[model samples]
Target: MGLPGTIPPAQGPARPALAVVDVQPHLQQPATDRGPGRLHLSAEGASRAAGGSGGGEAVKVILLRDVPTLGRAGTLVEVKEGYARNYLLPRGLAREATAGAIRARDVMRQAEEQRRARVQREAEQLAQGLSALILEMRARAGAEGRLFGAVTAQQVADALRQRGFPVDKKQVELEHPIRVEGFHRVAVRLPTGRLVQVTVNVVGQR
Candidate 1:
């Protein structure tokens, strides 16, 4: 009835290796959406939205505190309407959608602005003090003005200490170790949002 090795007809449906389906309407969630979020009130009166709380007919704003990465003052973030009502607003982390909350938010913003200005003023004062910083070096150099190797942070720190101004090596911010002989301005980090600039004058050895 058949030639050698001829196969018979198949009967049942083929098995599925894998199944892929569209996401159900309930499960179709967005990773990030812009909507209402929780508005956190600051002691200084600035309002920012804390993480997670947000929503409603009125736009929600979540107020966050002075997180290091997020800067000095609190910040507001908008989130979705539904999420704000069901989760964020009820948790006391954020206030309701109203005119009173908005007015309070403006006050909070003004307070934060004043604080920033004060910090900036202090930073300028620190910079001015650093003008007197002069670093001397003891290196073996030739007529062309190139050093034997390169000047490093350890060298700079040691020299600063001998001059009576004890500076920490870690506070120095250099793009690269000083190799060429020239005058350069190096930044020194200080406390309370302050920064100091030190002058480096590399001269040839006699």
Candidate 2:
């Protein structure tokens, strides 16, 4: 028997002693255990991580011809390794701008400049010719001046062709399709970066 509030001893091993369980050391390694430089990436691995092909680095190239949204001929441009390798290099549109390539580009620079000047002069002359020219188009329309069908760039181009001007429909830039009968100013973009406006006189057909 035990006094009040006193714990009685266990009768047998079926109820063993309440000893603290020993905790074994954790087997998992800490992040700090793997120090810096424990793993080094090769050149190929680094290149892949940097979005390059294989182990190849990006290169500087000289344009051999005009590239839309890019530099013109003889201009040095830096591009991705894959683009230089696959597109520009294979198409002969660009080359690695080494000392030799720079020399070659220098030799052709004068000719390219002359060609560009000639194109500019021709575009200016064409713009001047088109300035005074008015294209008349006849379309069926209602009494309120609303056209039965919209006037397209192709129709305007055809009118220009009939008037002895050689122009493609793509050269004409219209903000919207002409849907009314009236005189409207149309803008055309020339290859030499010149913008020319032509008067398109839309009249109702009799």
For each candidate, give its TM-score against the true structure.
0.40, 0.51
lDDT tens digits by residue: candidate 1, 162-202: 76654668767776888778887887775554567799888
Query: Residue 100 in model 1: shift from native, Å?
Result: 13
Model 2 weakest 10-residue run by lDDT: 37-46
- Candidate 2 per-residue lDDT over residues 70-101, each given as its tens digit: 55777898766765675567767778889998
**What is the alpha-carbon lDDT for the whole of candidate 2?**
0.75
The clash number for model 1 is 22
Give the clashing residue pairs of candidate 2, or none: none
**Backbone clash count, each prediction separately:** 22, 0
Candidate 2 residue runs with Cα over 4 Å from true position? 1-107
Question: Which lDDT value does model 1 have at 151?
Answer: 84
